[model samples]
Target: MSYREERRADAAAQAEQNRKAAEARAAQEREDRRLELETKLKAKEIAAEQKRRDAEAKAELARKEAEAKRRQELADKKVRAQEKERQAAARRARFGRVAGWLKANPATLFVAFVMVASIVPAVISQVGALSSAKVHVMLAALLAAMLEGGAWAITFMGKQAEDAGRETRKYRIATWLTAAAAAAVNFWHGLEAYAEHPWVAVVLGGSSLFAIYIWDMKTHGSHGKTREERRQEKARKKHLADRRKHHKEIAEEADRLLSALPFESITEEQAFETAWQIKRGTQPGLSAEIFAQVTGARVQLGAAFELGEHVRPELVRAGMLARLYNPLPGRLAEGIPTLGPSVPVPALQQAPEGATALAGIGVYGSEGASEKACEKASESASGNAGGNGSRGRSDEELEALLPKALKIAAELVAEGNQISGAALSKRLGIRRDDARRLRDRVIAERKLKLVEGQADAAVGA
Candidate 1:
């Protein structure tokens, strides 16, 4: 405000302006430094995130590659298995074809041989016997006609077999049947010739015998049953048998199936599906893969059934009941010891706690075993059962079960005599260890016999 004060004031004002400018510059510099630090932190975070993303992408690519490789290997394995199965089926088909070819041609060759060797000799003898030698011409004509007929029949049969796509049995039966009829005709012709010419009749009789013997051996001896009888029996059995069995049988047939299932282990659901397939008569035969999966599980599960030292009461009772209900529908004829058709088998047989009997024989044959042995075994099992009967069984139920158990035990004795323990165990799904013990007990108790090993050389060699 004064001269000296004014100069001082001007200096003071300049100083104040300088102070403000310096403070402003300092604040701007601090702000720029803070921004630079923030930028550095953001850049570091972005680099870390980018690295993490790259690592995740790499892991994802590796997983995809591994999955693709696994799929390729599985596909290749399936293809190889199918190819092998196809080759085996082809071999069987070829062998069947060759066998069919041989069967059809043999009869023609046999007829040719007979005509050339025997017929010519007979004709020559007849010619010599002829008063005018014209009989030789007639004999030759007859031989030619017979040979032609044989040729026609052989050709017709071969063609029919090829066209019909049936097995060899039909052709064999037809050939033998026709030969038998022809032999009868030949015999009648011999009888006629005998009235006029005795020598000719002798030749014809010899031919007839040869023909009949060959035909009889071929038709009756080989087959054990006549073709027509077999056909009729099959039809009758089919008519009587429950059609449910047909579904199971058809599904088990080995044709019209391609691939096996794809599973390391099949669940009960899969088994149920398989049963449905069988029941529906849809797929024929399980593939080796499916079978392998099932058998592998079966081995793991081990033997689930028990074996008995004596006869099983349940089977015996069932068999007796079947006998009593003589001519009972479908299953009774099969002679299988099961609960009645109306009875819910699954419910009745659940966890099946009954005696393990000899499983090989039918009911009646089992009933005939030494009654003494049966009585002894039954008394023992019944005694044991009675001791345990405190668990609660009505008198009626016990009475019913005892008779049934006796019948089953008797059946087992008869069955054990016929089949070996191992076969019986396998058939009935019983444990081998249990079967062995039961077999030993039966033998020790005289319910079964143990035949000592015979000298193989003396018996068969």
Candidate 2:
């Protein structure tokens, strides 16, 4: 019993041990399989998350690209709109200039209307669209009336302007005659004849209108200025030119007179007395103040009359005043003293050689003439006394007189009067020197030139 029991017990115990070992192995295998499954599941979840992130990045890039495309489209649209506006503005400016030009040229407008109207009727007649002879005649009459009316109106206005003294009556009679002739021709041909020869009527009417235009242009100038205005302008220019020429001549004469003096050989008193004699001979009754002023102007003759280069009138006047008022040291003052008592003058039997030269030089009456001569001179002088005097004239007075003086000068010049400084002095009642200076200033400012042959014509007159 002991041997059998021992063998069985040992086998059972070994079997039990084997069963436990198998159970342990099975649990380990199950745990390893569960771990592998959990690892695979985690790897799949990570891969899905990465795919989601990639899709979101792609969507963001697409959104940015779409926004960029939209902005580009808007910019392009704005550029196109601006270009269109610029083009439209340019077109408007061009049209505006064209309109302004058309407005300024009324003659061109009338011509354009005539051309277009004539063309329309002619085209209709040629196309046989308007077969009515009466219609063509009516159109012809209308065109003829317009042409005749325009011509008549222009002629009537010109005549009225002439009557109003706004224009010279140049071509007024001729213009009326031309207008009447045109009216007569148009009406004499009659409407039915015009319809039969529509083109002939157009030609005749166009020619008459053109003739009127040409006549107007010839008479009134292309700018439509009246003949009187043109004449006045011409006269004004001539006057300024004559004045300039006169001034130049006077300046040259003054230079010549100064050049003839011998200052070095003569004493101051002798030179002064000689100059005074010459001045008195040339311009009798000249006031002491004016003589003093003249002496001051030529003071460059030093203490004696001296030869010098050409000098301006203003400079001469200034020199004379300075010499008389401001004496050098150790020299007698050359101041102009008060006038002596008046003395009876002797009558001259004949005109002096220098009398004519002195005729227009001074504002005072001519001396040493016979009683009758003096009376006659006084009558002529009285009319020009107020005009030719500069004495006591204020600045305002001079300014007020200037326009009228200029107008007279212009008229005189237009009449072929060669206005010398002496003549201007007499006419304006100013000093010869002052006249010279004023003439120069006006000519320069006005940009005038003497007409060719005007001086010869004036001298002859």
Candidate 3:
């Protein structure tokens, strides 16, 4: 009974211990599964967060790109708009000028053209009926008139530029028709003279034919033409017409300015040359001040020989007073100091050579002889009378006329008086740092004369 009880108790204790160990192992396995599930969920959440952030960043980048594109397009549009506006403004200005020219000289131009076409033919007929010598003279005159008339009509009518080109075409056609008709009439007369009096007609007809050949040759300024040649001729003529119109506008502007300035008398050629020079501004002689005066030009030379009171204002505004002012305009005659005419006083002479040379150098050749004479006389007299005898220019005068400090400094550099930066600084009385800058500037200025060339040496000689 005791052995059976002991065996049963031992088995019970072992069973209980085994059950506890299995329970602990099961608990541990459940905790491990829970931790794995939690770790997987956290990983999924982190991945989702990363994807969301990436999507947000991409959206922001796209928005920025679109904004940049829109801004670029707007800038381009603004630039295009500005360019278009500038072009339109230029066109309107050109048209306005053409309109004004036609309005101002309408009657004169029309009458001139009509007389040229009609009067020429009438005179030729009249002269032919008269003496033989008269006939030749009249024929020559007629030919000249015809050539000039054709050119003027073509040039003006083309520039009369209305919106429609139809009018210009009609005008051109009329000019050609008139030329043909005039030629036909001339041919008919030649034929009639030949038929009526064979001997005299031969001479007259030959003479007329010769005249015709001369006219065509001189007028066309070229050889015979083919179909392609004719097309090119038409294009060239159109180009010439455009040039003439531009010239006409410039001419009209000149006329208006001349009428306003009663003191000085400037020719159309002078005005044109001056205006062109001012506009180009490519030369060192033409400074900013001179350009300003020319661009703002509302004055021109007049028939009046004497300089007007307005000269002061113009010279002052032009910054040319220091160079060209005359002090005798408002001064007393006695105080002005009169010189005896022994060694040819500059004022006594009608013209001097220096003014002419200066004018040529300045490219202002259309200056009136009378104006040049006056200017030369005044300038020479003033320059000489103030300080010296016949030789002119006293030591005091020379000293007074010495170049300014800045001018001296510039001249030294221009003459290549220095090379290195330190040397240049000493020569120019400037700092070493400034000398480097000046050297750079001088190098950039392409036309600055750093050395006295043959031209200067010759001039000095």
Model 1 lDDT, residue 63, Cα:
89
Pairs that clash in candidate 3: 264-301, 264-302, 265-301, 265-302, 266-301
If scored against the real structure, what TM-score would every candidate get? 0.27, 0.32, 0.27
Candidate 1 residue-wise lDDT, 1-461, digit = tens: 57999999999999999999999999989989999999998999898899899999999889889999999899989898888888988998898887787688676557566645653443333333342334566774565445434533653675576557756566555554654444444445555546677666566535533543444344346647788999999997775353336544443331223124444355533554465565543332334454455444323211111123233476345434534554335654233223222222242233222122233321112322323333344344322322333243444543444443434444545444332234334443334333333433443333332222234434775
lDDT (Cα atoms) of all candidates against the true structure = 0.47, 0.50, 0.47
Residue-level lDDT of model 3, residues 143-248, one tens digit each, is 5456435644654565464334445656545655654554444455555655665465344333323433333333344445888989999998886576458666
Quote model 1's TM-score.
0.27
- For model 3, the superposed segments whose C-alpha errors exceed 4 Å read 1-13, 96-461
Candidate 1 wrongly placed segments (more than 4 Å)? 82-150, 154-461
- Please count the clashing residue pairs in each candidate, in the order shown: 8, 11, 5
Residue runs of model 2 more than 4 Å from their true location after superposition = 1-31, 83-87, 104-107, 115-236, 243-461
